[model samples]
Target: MKENVFYGKGMGPVKKDYPDIYEAIVGLNDAVYTGKALDYKTQKLIALAIAASNSDDRAVKKQISSVVETFDTSKDEIMDVLRIVLLTSGMPPFVKAVNLLYEVID
Candidate 1:
């Protein structure tokens, strides 16, 4: 029932059961993806960073895979985001993200 937020697919029953919530979530996604202050790639990296900070493996992998596939995002650029996590979220989450990153990118 959980949608892949990146592709705008996989809404499952949410579209039929909770139309309002689904629309709001879709709207929020649109708002976040708008290129106002940060560019799209930068925003995606931040999203990956947030996933890392939360230690959410599914989200972390999804974001990582999406970035790698969608953009010409470099390994170093991905590391740059993880490096920020190392500073703010500390070693655990940073390590988790880095490990997952290797799995996804490799």
Candidate 2:
């Protein structure tokens, strides 16, 4: 599995390195289960939008790639999510996210 960006390496060891915290978070998975309500395609789109809004390039690109691989979602659909993020999250962060997305997708 890929390491989490927040707790991995240069970010320093926090809850990720602690077995108790990790287990606690893992146990809390039931609190926010995504299930099959939106389907993989829609879930990826929502994830992309949220990542973009939050200015998380790694997460945005990761979700974009996952959507491409799993649901065969196109670049246009990913861009649409970015557009929505721009509307909700403002220009600067969205620009950075879009640049990162282009870097990965292109």
Candidate 3:
């Protein structure tokens, strides 16, 4: 399985040192990201929104950077999601998401 860009540093050793567990996690990720009700892009957006809403800086950056790197998501599109973060998650999370967005775009 290819490494997921979003996996945290805590997971690095798990992938290298625990091959079976890493395979299991990769399978689970495929199950979740395979898109059922929503299409792939929409699901990714939802994931990004959730990450931003949680105010997890690394998660937010990883999600945004992964989308930009692995898919065709645009800056305007990401900013739109961050706008929703502003309304639903409040200023701190929204600002942090926006900051990460800029860094990713650059």
Candidate 4:
């Protein structure tokens, strides 16, 4: 199994069956998450937005939980990102993210 990249739902089989690919994914995760100019929180917020925009419920929840545990993120901060999702990805994703945020936070 993958020692890194622990948030996804599909990595287990990939890790067991395709160790080389899993390592590459881990490398990519490290490179992407190691913020350059945006800083860690900003990068995570962007990831949250992307997850929300994609309407990925599991990813949205994971991102919210990770953000909450890893940073001092406020509900307003997450709502701020969701607002962008509302405008760009429409009401469905925005609403889903809002609900998931509540589920994760409360």
Q: Highest lDDT among the candidates is held by which one?
A: 4
Give the Å shift of residue 49 in candidate 1: 0.7
Q: What are the TM-scores, per candidate, against the unseen true structure? A: 0.86, 0.68, 0.84, 0.89
Q: What is the lDDT of residue 26 in candidate 4?
A: 85
Candidate-wise lDDT, in order: 0.84, 0.68, 0.83, 0.88
TM-score of 3: 0.84
The best candidate by TM-score is 4
Model 4's alpha-carbon lDDT is 0.88
Per-residue lDDT of model 4, residues 1-106, tens digit only: 1125477667899899999999998898888777678788998899899999999999999889888878869999999999999999999999999999999989
What lDDT tens digits, residue by residue, belong to model 3 across residues 2-105? 23553677678988999899888878888887766877777778889999999988888888877776676999999899899999989999998988888888
**Candidate 2 structure quality by residue, lDDT tens digits, 1-106:** 2223232333345454776776565555433335457554675588678878888767777777776777777778777887888889999878887787778778
What's the C-alpha lDDT at position 25 in model 2? 59
**In candidate 1, residue 13 scores what lDDT?**
74
Runs in model 2 deviating more than 4 A are: 1-24, 27-33
CA shift at 74, candidate 3, in angstroms? Answer: 1.3
TM-score pick, better of 1 and 4: 4
